[model samples]
Target chain A: MPHTTPQTPGLFSLSLSKTVEFALNQALRLDEAQGAAFKDFEDKTFAVTFTDLGLTLYLFFTSYGVNVQNALQGEADARIETDLPSLLGLRETGRLSRVTLHGDVPLAEALIDALTSIEIDWEEHLSHYTGDLIAFKVGHATRSAMAATQAAKRQAGETLKEYLQFELEVLPTASQLQRFGDSVQRTQAAVDAIETRVQALLDRL
Target chain B: MNQSKKTIDFGFSEVPLEEKVKRVKGVFDSVAGKYDVMNDVMSLGIHRLWKRHTIELSGVRPGQTVLDLAGGTGDLTKAFAKRVGKSGRVVLADINESMVRVGRDRLINEGIAGNVEYTITNAEALAFPDNTFDLATIAFGLRNVTNKDKALAELYRVLKPGGQLMVLEFSKVTQPLLAKAYDFYSFNILPKMGKLIADDEASYQYLAESIRMHPDQDTLKQMMLDAGFDKADYLNMNEGIVALHRGWKY
Candidate 1:
């Protein structure tokens, strides 16, 4: 049996479960397992005890959002089975069957959940902090603009054209400038959006 | 009996097929010594500005590879080597052996030796592996290619992911009055300048005609997109006498 010790929290430290210990002991009897490192021996048989864990981890790490079927197809097409099976104590059909049959899904599911939760938390924190700053800046500009507009209306003295010209000529307050900038940005975004759609259409032709 | 397909337009003039290459070669070979001189003379030193603009648009950085296609006399290639630094490489390639040899010797004489390679390659049939180059440029060379689309596709194939292709070439004039004046200057005055300066009248005449026959801006942009380039766009310069077309492989 392979003896191990815990190293860190949440990260894999030197610790072997009872199933892992049993597999390691059984693997030592095989000629292929002779002179092999503990990590190497465990990798060879973990799949038998952990069935498809190596492939699953490989697919997840390599193609982040790829579907399981596609990942499997890619692995099979690339002839990864022979090397992978031998490397992980999946030497015999019986050992492979045992791992697949006994390995639990809850651990893999828990790992995925933890990773997703971390991503969401980081994004949420950035948005909240940035959004607050933007809103405060916008609010201050709006108040200043409104005051200037009212002052201009008072000074313009009744002729509609003069009042209109005054309104047009009034230096845009920071809020007004921000709104103008936003509109220009939105217009540019729309142009880019349309260009992409048009390009896609052209590509089909 | 079908008339012997005797003459084809080298630009607009009817020239025999055997004569076109000789004519084209004469244009570069004649201008070989004064090519840089005449560029400054003809464009009133705005050629330097245009070449600088091309360099700026190239987005060349340290540790990047660049291929200056149809690079005559090594002007652009010299500037490119400095930007790419000692770690990066620049190849000054031209189809014409005379132009290539002249450019190579000029660069060697200038002591711009390290990190530069010279090759005589046709734009349509570049002897390079696919997706190897970071950037490829055909400065004033696209119009002369026998098959523009094939050359463009070849350029597309050589570019690595996120690589750029820039073409600085003559384009259609936008203003009618400017077009008329340009035509008169190109047809009448340029040949006279060529005869007096370079002593080659027919070669400069071919240059003027080729500019007119070349496709305009919008057509080139569409062709670039068809060649699998994303965000293909052009910037017209000098009332559209010249345009810089840019595209990227992603």
Candidate 2:
């Protein structure tokens, strides 16, 4: 917490919240999905309690813009409580279960849904910090490689399973493990018999 | 506005302290209509981020009182008004009538009336009572004040115990090469752009000079301490192009 209020013993948390708010607003401005998430919920108020710090962050929507503040007193359309670690982790996992909602759970979920809609173009953003060419190349390569690897994984798994089950018949159809083993042994015996006959014929010639 | 017997620095030139406020006001009045526009051109729209950062750092809460001193065009005031909601009180005060008028009108146009109050006030002698606000901010406007020491004292007087005041203003560019390039841009290009956009070059030139005339980062932190702040600190942004100084009146 970086931007905590004057009363709070921790100033850090307030700063962190402020940064988060700025980023959220910036994303909302550029992203239609994120902006639309709050559009339907205008004039709604929600409270988020950082249970560990004993601070309740209240978010209220106004005609102008969304407001994020500490909810000292009063009721809201929704109130959510979660620890700091869980709150941060929710971004990565995209899990609403990490937070507990009191008033309007569905609205809270919708808010999260809006946040999930924000698409981060890390390569484009990083280009400004790093270099344009490097960022583009890296981003492109990463997406291509990831797609190829995922496709290969799915196709390879399916093809190998099908080949073993249908073509080779090495895979058991049911719980008949002994029957499958016998079938494989029978095939092996037939192959051995053919090889032995060929060797005996070759010897006679 | 308070004036001392000693002379004050007015853009590389020392002048009578009494004359600084009127001159500063003249500059702001001349460019009141174009101030926001010039800010966008001069900083390349980075001023918004700087201001947003200041507001974020101020840590203003709902139902808390905030004094947006020198809130020209109500950039900080609009955000504060929204954050404070109906319960909170935000006073968008500026000494310059032109800037204050612009701020009031802008806030009104934005439909932000309930929580915000507009006032024309000199920072050296704030009109409000003691312990009036939980947070006070002077962004890019403190440099224009005639008596900064007196203004800081007045801010301290108005703030509640544990209340914080944030001063976001242009400061020294520490890097020499960057400073030289910045100087070239300010002296050569900024005024020309101002003349083209606002039809006012002197005010833009004054703005550039004022940035240089304002105290450096460490000096401002010391001034905040001397003004009876229990804790004072500053974080430089854009490589010391602007600094956000924060002081707690505990």
Candidate 3:
């Protein structure tokens, strides 16, 4: 568990919170769904505690968007505990399992769900700064790179498995494992027969 | 010749009480457009930190009314408006019409309208009802008021029972070396920067003088207590260059 002692946030922490608030609101604004998922969460407060940073940012939902601040007056509706990396991962993957939630579990689930539901059109946003053709090219290049990386990862895994099983002979082959399983079953049956014979002799005596 | 007429400090100079109001109004009017810019440049962008600390200490909750007295450019008001949500309200009141106009326009441009109200009113005589606001704040504007005690009293009067008042202002520096350097910068560089940027040297000079004339941390805390606050305390930031005085009405 992270230490819960509240220290006064320095200017750097305040600046970080403001930056996060600005980025989150900007993303929500660019959302194709118009952030409709967050409409029901008005006036809800979610305290997100970063274990590594020892900081808690109170995310207060309003009609406009969420306000992130260091100090909160009262108990929040939901509290989430996680490290910095986990929070970043949660944002990228939109997975609630990345953090441990306390207090109103339902509210935490709904908040995360609503946050994940916002669909921002990245290409459209990029095109505002770059021309359509450049944006499309960048997007295409990014997608191709990601796909190539996945393919390479899959190929590397298959090669490693083949090398370990066939060339190195460190791991058993499929047929060898199958035969070993059969031998174990046969030995177990013989042991069962011997146990039955002993039981019969004991009973006669 | 007119000793019977009261005189007050307008910067380092003494002027009639009514003239001081006009002088303060003129200074704000001259710098209203470039107030935010000048603040950033003058403080090396540390004014934002000061204000951030003030907001952190506010501990404001949803559905609570706030009075941002002397809320020029509506920085504090904008933050409070978001925190208070749709049900609550924040009044951005200022003595200078020019300052209020600029603040109102800027806030409106930023889409901070529904929960915020703008008014041009003197701090010594607030236009709100007694025991009305959950929180009241006067930031960087206390020294410009003709009567500091009267303004503090008004802030205390407008706050509801259990509500708090936060005063964020420039104060006397505690360290001698830093104080000497700060004084040199204020008296020498600040006005020139104002002239270079805002085209107003005199107003910036007045700013430095007014800050010097403002009460120190302890004095301001005592003033809040004298104004009927049950408990009063202060937190100095940047080694006493700026202080945040908080008083709770019980």
Candidate 4:
């Protein structure tokens, strides 16, 4: 009932909460605006209940940054209840349709907007430890790898479509699908005409 | 060495009641600088989780007062301050001035000053007014108290009606095999860690003995009930290596 999962197994939740807290605070510090996005949300608490994990993490907004913990002595100002898949969908699509938000709805929406608006200059931060040139090289390599992966994925999809449509004849080709659509439309028209004739005969009777 | 002198247990050794307090103070004073480090090294950083669990169970709310008695180094105090925010107040009180100073300085450095206060007060006789705190905690500091019953009474007295007190301390290990291994580790390896990290072997030795001398889980629950708590219960962590005793004042 309580978010005690973190305390159940060797305090794994505590470690996770600490890691998330540290990362969120670090992100806030690294933001170019210096956490100005969260200024208005100070002292407000947001809770995210991961239904799949059966854990609720409370994110307390402070003047400096956010403090994330699994337990809250009191209720959160905004609580979002969703499973992992829906959460991932929300992240990918930037949509709140999949998750349920309770309490101050406007506050939750604003918090989500603020979170999505956070833009950290990762390359700039990385350059602090690894100088400008090296950081540039690493960032360049990562971008190149991502581009290559996307290209490969597109090529694979095309190849699978060709094999399925041509080689194996397992899926209908474009022309065949068009013909099937026409036939279905024609059949629907014929059925409508037959129904109209039957209704007329019944009216005469 | 008068035969009529009141005596108390200082670790494994018996000493005069007044002397016990002084010696306990000396131990904390010696280890004050390296207390946090020694705790991490000895407990493998699991002490933080134990304290976190205690805080979770406290159900502390904003605008409610909390007293972290024997709050050496203020780990719980820092967490409570964040939750209580600007509206609530937290008092970090400890008997040993050295420990209190370390906790105060650490909390201030972490920018936790506005809603938090620090004090040097004995657990047996807290300085706060009656029914003052909504939540009170004594983590790992109760074992060192000269009179635990008196200290429990003081904690109960300070708590508001419907308030809660959480005591996080080392207790008897539940598993027999683990208990034997823990005994071996506490006696043989723990002191070595203290010696290596804190450079104080004697104080660490006393730490281990005091834990063994502290009351077991059920015993502590009964003591809280005797202290006038309406309800008292305990939860064992790490196979009973540490226990959190909670008492509610109605």
For residues A23-135, write the lDDT of model 3, one tens digit per residue: 67887888887778888878888888876555688887787687888877667889988765554455467664458889998998888787667653333433343453344
* lDDT tens digits, residue span A52-149, model 2: 55566656665456666542323667777876556545556665446787888898778767656675332333234345334544765788789999
Native A-B interface contacts kept, per candidate:
0.00, 0.11, 0.44, 0.29
| Poorest 10 consecutive residues by lDDT, candidate 4 chain A | A1-10
Best of the candidates, lDDT: 3
Candidate 3 chain B lDDT trough over 10 residues, lowest sum: B55-64
Residue range B1-250, candidate 1, lDDT tens digits:
3334566567987776557656677678778877877777677887766666676446455456888999988888987776566667898989888888888889888877788999988788898899878888888989877668888999999988778888999999999999999999999998888888778777788788999989999999999999888768888888899998988888
Best by TM-score: 3
- TM-score of predicted chain B versus true chain B for each candidate: 0.93, 0.95, 0.98, 0.98
lDDT of 4 at B42: 91
Worst 10 residues of 1 chain B by lDDT: B1-10
Q: Which residues of candidate 4, in runs, are more than 4 Å off?
A: A1-10, A89-91, A119-205, B1-4
- In Å, residue A112's CA in model 1 sits off its true spot by 47
Model 4: per-residue Cα lDDT over A87-175, one tens digit each: 43544556545577899988888877776566533334333434533444566578878999999999999999999999999999889
- Using TM-score as the yardstick, the better of models 3 and 4 is 3
Every model's DockQ: 0.01, 0.06, 0.18, 0.15
Output the chain A TM-score of model 3.
0.53
Preferred candidate (lDDT higher): 1 or 3: 3
The residue pairs in collision within model 4 are: none
Candidate 2: stretches off by over 4 Å: A1-65, A68-205, B1-6
| Better-scoring candidate (DockQ), 2 or 4 | 4
- Count of residue pairs whose backbone atoms collide, per candidate: 8, 9, 0, 0
